[model samples]
Target: MALRETDPAEVGGYRIEDRLGSGGMGVVYLARSASGRRLAVKVVHAQYADDDEFRTRFRREVAAARQVSGAFTAPVVDADADASRPWMATLYIPGEDLGTHVRRHGPLPPPQLRELAAGLAEAIRDIHRAGMVHRDLKPANVMLAEDGPRVIDFGISRATELAAADVLTQTGRVMGTPPFMSPEQFSSPQDVGPAADVFSLGSVVAYAATGHGPFDSPSPYETAVRVVDGDAELDGVPPELLPFVQFCLEKHPKSRPSPDELLHLLREGELPDPRPAAAPAPAADAPRAPRARRRRRLLLASALGALLLTAATALTVLAVDSEPAPSAGDLPAGWQEWHKKSKDPNVDEDPIDADGPFSRCAATGRSLVCAGDDVMATRFALADGSNTWARPIDDTPDELGSGDLGTVIAARGGRAYVYGADDRTEGDANPSRYTVQALDADTGKVIWKTVTGDGQEATEPNSEQGYSVAVPEGVVAVYGAKGQQYALLDADTGEVRWKRPLPDPDSRICLLRSAAGNAYLVCQKWTDDNVTGTSFTQLDPADGRPRWTVTVAKDQDVVGQADGRLVVLNTTGTRRTITLINAASHIVTTVRMSEPQPESATPTLLNGTLYVTFPSGSVRAVAPDSGRRLWESNSTVESPGLPIASASHLYLASPSGRLAALNVRTGAVEATLQGRDDGGTADSSAPGAPPTLVGDALYVPYGIRSVYTVDMHTLRA
Candidate 1:
């Protein structure tokens, strides 16, 4: 394959070298990073890139690739769905597909055939153990890399608890190659469990051993039918392995042996003597990097990261490499290291989920309460960092996005309130029976919890996404709705001050805060995956009574309250505008943009101004009412999280924990602090959550389970 004139020269910073192949979905290209790391970059076809569903599947594919990590699999290196032409990169293994090899070289001898079966079986086992099924495992998807058969292409893979994640397989539309597809895939694609891959592996091994498919048909339709009710044509398969292949190609999915069983069958007496660990199968004319260069690159893994500095984590793999172990000498004034009683898993639940998502602690007057990857919730004395109490969450967090999505933990008045769910002991199946708990932050004890109506949707906290909780004078007021239910709960006492039915099932109730006041609840509706409209409902928590309610256009998103008016951003599509709406008069005015809007910019409103941070590290300030750009600062930090505003300063953090501050009015850099490049676990999501600014201190959390705070007063312009 060669480069075409239409293909872009580069994608997401990786320079395209040559086209590896093109398929129905995208084109795979040989690419190299600035660090000289060879990669297989797949750029989705323009037609599919425009389809939202395709983008989602690609996002899921990146997520699925992160869940797996083994010597047998090609690890995902980088991906950006938000890019104009969405692309993903994985470590490049120079090799040919198993099918391509058999086609050019003919059938494999028994010894190599046995190794192929073992490698493919192991690859399937790794995917299955990750609680996912690689629905499309055909000869074409199996790459005979130098390190063994690396299972590639997870574009159609889905996890086991897929009521929410995957809709493609659940719909049961025909996917994957007809001949290699399992029988169950034809009838119950949604429920085609891990065993489905085993059946495909049998067919693949048979094809490699013989020269043709077990169920060869003139058409895909006939091939699918034969897959359900037909026997295999195993004439050319080696006699010694025919029975095993037949067992794998069973009409019933259950009849097929598991990956482990198949591995045992192939590796047992098939080898006269114990075989040393099988390395990558060497095939003539396979794509190969120079051995000398490859060896040198392996030795320079640590120092090679300087070339990857463009992205805070492209993993820069500064996240993947460990620095010298931190000692007490490196600990802050009173900080000390502590671990949860429960052990940290070898791999995190999700890629973006750091060892601690909200690694930063919330200062509760005298003590600090926090939640993280290893320690579910813990408290320590600010004076000495002595562990007051520590609580470890479930080994595998109940919610997969628990860390990626904003996590809420607020501590005040000597009582800490953490967001979580409390099952009614009647099984966790019914969402209606579930209650959102406000636990005592200090001891991990349940202090108060609120039960919603019919449990229509999962409980989202007073955190960023849709809802918020505020403790004014001792009573906590929570604003959020689940299903058709909304509640103003006493977060401390667990009492419902007011409850009412919401308008839409897809609406998210957000409590907007501003310098003026924090008494407004903004509910935004989503229809067909699009934010349709927003309604502002002002209320009093003391009486749980409504003050007034107003509705705005479908495209508007309430950023915050400004000068006694609701400041919203109209996100209709590619073009976005800021809209200011009067909560009382219901008058709407659109603020004109002084500059082009950045793609996927995270916006935060402070006082009467809005600050936008782009992935490229550009910060912009705009007047909320006028939509006028005040100033824009090009930052040195390549990747930054969402910016949070303090009185006169705007603060943002990089993946490496670098913190930057700028003047809210001028958008000029005031101060910058370098962060430690602590090696973090492999994750595909954004670098990490933004650092939290509380009172006069900025707290930066890390994946290695530590928090470093700096005094804002020390930063000088």
Candidate 2:
């Protein structure tokens, strides 16, 4: 592309000589460093230069890229993410990205394919070793340098999702080019690891060999479906190269070779083929089995970034790390850790929920109250690993009943407040009835229960719904997602103090919180025309009256409560903007993010600061008031649970069956303890249940239904 007259002559001390390319996020300019070295300088789009989220993201990309070390990857020469235009300069190797190279000519030869594969594998290994994943590894991001294939983009993290949402033309269309994506990237984008890049490399090598994507289609959607559900067509691929490509495309990330492993496999130039099975002629009376099973394509995710295989609710085992809500004091003496299964002991994990975190746990100062699979509610000792009670709450008449105890509303006083619901209808999609119950902390005895009178209106079965953290001198629970209702009950007696109903039952309300005994929530609504937005409402829990409301953009989250304000993170395209709504006047204030954030979940807000932990085990703390990042710590744990914090430490659990403690002040990993290796699936549990701090002791839960506690005093030492 030729440089336009409007192009800047210089940026960040580099002299811009020409235009390399323009992407949704920014423009790549050919520049020269002071040392007379040629460089590829990527300048952020003017529109995004002022965007806090993109800027933060760019900073993260630079940080991550600087960590990668290898010959087959572009090296970061210099970067100024904090510059006016936020530009990054890399050693500009004179070569075309793989896509242009192949399109301009034809597919590479077999030897070149081997080189490309090996080079990319080496690059990915460098990235993985840096504790990062090159999620956006596509043809355009791979530079075919003279030495080898140089992987370009390394920081293609969450921001890539936003970048992928750009429309190609006026009529409105997705810009995703899906031929090279991995299936699980589509199926479970949150759980990607080093193996995902291997899948992309396979696709790139296949395209380099065959002049087309393994799952190419006329349309991106069809291409996505093919990548997710269809077969990889490597017809023209050489026999020797087929094994490497096939192994890289495994459906399960764990099955793919690591960087070291990939090097070993390609060392001899091929993978060993499985022993030939007896081939039988098609049965005259029976249909043939499904075509030879191909590798599961790992689909790449975008904020709608390239192609996101529509959310397939099929995979149920998301890590929902279970632990007591409000833990009391230090770890008990003479404590020995115990482990159990979160999966149903009777029927087995649902095929969909392979890592079925079927169980949830709570501590009421007496015992760990749990519910999952076949068990309704069970109490295990808080002091020792002994069963206090096991109450079966699953066999209820509510057909669509949670099949376990319902959402653990909250633990307070000496009881566990539970939001219980189930579908009485035969095939209803949502819960047909809803109610609240107070369970004994030690005995698992029901202290009190109440079925909301409006239980006839069935609500969609959403395990993510019905959660409430508002406790103005009592535990509050939100019942029905769309039909928003708030119940204020006594923490000790489970007696209903008041019920606050919204304008409609279908008004989606979330983020129930209490600040200084004041109740607040964000209500969401969707129109038929696909219009979506949210209203931040502050309610008087003492009187059940709304004090004020502030409406914000769609797909936003109330990340935390700040002094005199509420921190709201709004997503517009690929950018996540932070807005602070004044508690008194409902005025809006925007906070510029200090750096880019990866896909974050289970955000914890404390004392004017917001904390978010990622599936990659990276945790960040940002001050909503100043938009300054306090710290960002990377951990070895994968798919960490929701994050919770204390005065000086932050705590979280992982599906890898471990609990971790990080220093809040320095983002330093303080301590880690292995929970249980029940062979639980990473995708089996949700990231909602965070590690809990009761008094000075920290309780962490494992996906396979194990709980471990850490003594804060011991941890600090």
Candidate 3:
């Protein structure tokens, strides 16, 4: 392309040779540096340079590009965002953009397709690790170089931490090409994250494979609707790559695999079949494959001179480095603290979710099992934080309904127990059938499953509610859907040993707590939000019979049991009280608190002390025996989970993965571990999973699909 008269003669003192391209924001010109090195200098247009918002975005783009350095990404050589024209220069490569190549040379062959997929996967993975999301990843932004594909053009890229404040994402404004944009980009632009880029990659790969996007349409509006509706057309894509491409086109962001997972698929070369058909022998006239080239070396003197020149010109330039993301050695495999994505290798954790997503994990000894809206039942080794196995979510989307999906109840007796329900529409009303499943602790295989009759549960199981109890020995007691019948099933064979109707039909169970081999139900009947009657019932573990039933005060709810006594707390009224009832003697003693406890505080009884943690990160230790306030400490954690304690200290985690430890006696801040920012916003509605303690190891789940393990002995403030 020849340079037009209107094109600038030079940019940032670099001689402009030819006009490479022009986009909505600016024009990219082929330029030559003083040392005769080729560079691509992009200069903002006059209209955009005058727009303050556009200049701010350009400055952000320059900063983001400087942070990313990888073999598959163009290296930013120099940038002056404060200049009059706001120009940036990058190392120029001799190649055509992927869209142009595919249009000129036809669909890429299988060999080249595999190479391109791997390169792009690595490129995006690196970009995400640098805390940025390339919002625009269409074929036009990828260059088909001789070595591999190189991702270019960060004009629309954004730092994930600042996504919430992005002004361009305001309503009625859309970014990225319609054919390549993700569903979330159009529906919830403010919530678009790294998964959006993965969706665009799928579209780009589909275009490279078949010379057309999956949601191709003449009208941009129609293409956007097709993407949001999950209407993809992959008729021309090769069968070998069909499933891989489809995996990336999932309607839900969490359902799509990560870039690391995509790279694994490409490396395995096993999309149903490992062996691809041999390519037809190329014609003799065809050009031979280009030999692999080594990285260009820079002389020490020249590098020093460039650094000095950068200082003189007040420009930002970074040396290209080939460092990759963290590897196994960098992870907390043994004793060191480590963090990783909560993913399984064998199972495709594409969940069919009905309820809002959040992780619930249960741990026993050295085994940890977790399930959530996005993850199925996955077991991780508590010693090294390695995923052992995972049970996939139900793949039958046609029958998916509004009920529980992969909710881990408890892990005990060498097994993990989970429950889910399927909604069946038999008439005007939708009834749900619940199923309880048990999986082997060592292997992820399902041990047994028991389904109940078609009826919705009287109350849904949630963080604040309970429906099932996992007995440590070999029995699981579950309440039927109608909440009338209680069944005791054999954990080993899934056989119902006994089914009996629950007593006291007029009362509703408010809290179900099990401790010291005894299950206690606090039943209360309310009239217009006012409690009319309240009673406590202790159920027999052997035959599902109530061993004892006693009436109690309406305001007290059973929280935990300690020293053969149930610790009850008055959680509702302005005048808070603690009551301790002897399980055998039936003698109750009540003590009034000095101050009323906050309604949002979570209480957990450990070592005969009741510890309550507020949402403001203030914790208080109360003596149930005498209502004495031991101590209260205002820690730095916000939105803290339920506090768990050892003999000396109490530990809790925030939704952001921040781990804080407090001394038990004095309630002093002991130690803290800063949370990791996984480049995604936290879901405020999702319940935060409490930290699981196995000996000295603490496993904390936070942010977006990430879990980290830290040693209690090695934690630092």
Q: What lDDT does each candidate get?
A: 0.57, 0.59, 0.64
Whose lDDT is higher: candidate 2's or candidate 3's?
Answer: 3
Q: Write the per-residue lDDT of candidate 1 for residues 1-717, one digit (tens) a residue.
A: 878899888889899999999886688999999999999998887765555655676677678778888777777899998777788888888888988999999998987887787888888889888777888898888898766788887766777666232323223233566678776555434456887788898899899988888887654423543565456878878887886687677654545677777777776633223322222232432222112211121112211111111111111000000111123123234443322221232133332224334433565544566654434456655435455565443223333122222233455665665444322222533232223455564455767755543342333342332333443522233334333345656656767777655443323423333223345555555443334566777666666466777777664445666776777664322224677777668677776777645333556676567777666678888887777789999765655756666778888777666778888878788889876654353232234545555455556654454556666667552
lDDT of 3 at 16: 96
Clashes of 1: 7
- Superposition TM-score, candidate 1 onto the true structure: 0.50
Residue-level lDDT of model 3, residues 1-717, one tens digit each, is 898988888899899999999986689999999999999998987755554545677788788889999999988999887788899999897899999999899999988887888888899999999888898999999998888999998877888887764433322124577689887665444557899898899998899999999998644423543676436999878887877799788766756778887887776754333222222233433322110000000011111111112111111111001111123123223544666555532233223322222357776545677775434477777656677676543322222222223456677766777754444456654445556677786687878977644463332232223445555443344456655666666767878877767554433433444665566565665443245556777877677678887776664556667778887765342226777788998888878886665433556777788887665678888887777899999867876766667778888787778888999999989898787776144543333566666666677877755578876777842
Q: What digit string (tens of lDDT, one per residue) describes model 2 on residues 678-702?
A: 5454334344345556667666665
Residue 487, candidate 3: C-alpha displacement in angstroms = 1.8
Highest TM-score model number: 2
TM-score of 2: 0.53
Model 1 segments more than 4 A misplaced:
1-356, 359-361, 372-376, 393-406, 422-446, 451-462, 471-482, 506-521, 524-532, 542-545, 584-586, 678-684, 715-717
| Models sorted by lDDT, best on top | 3, 2, 1
Candidate 1 worst ten-residue window by lDDT: 314-323
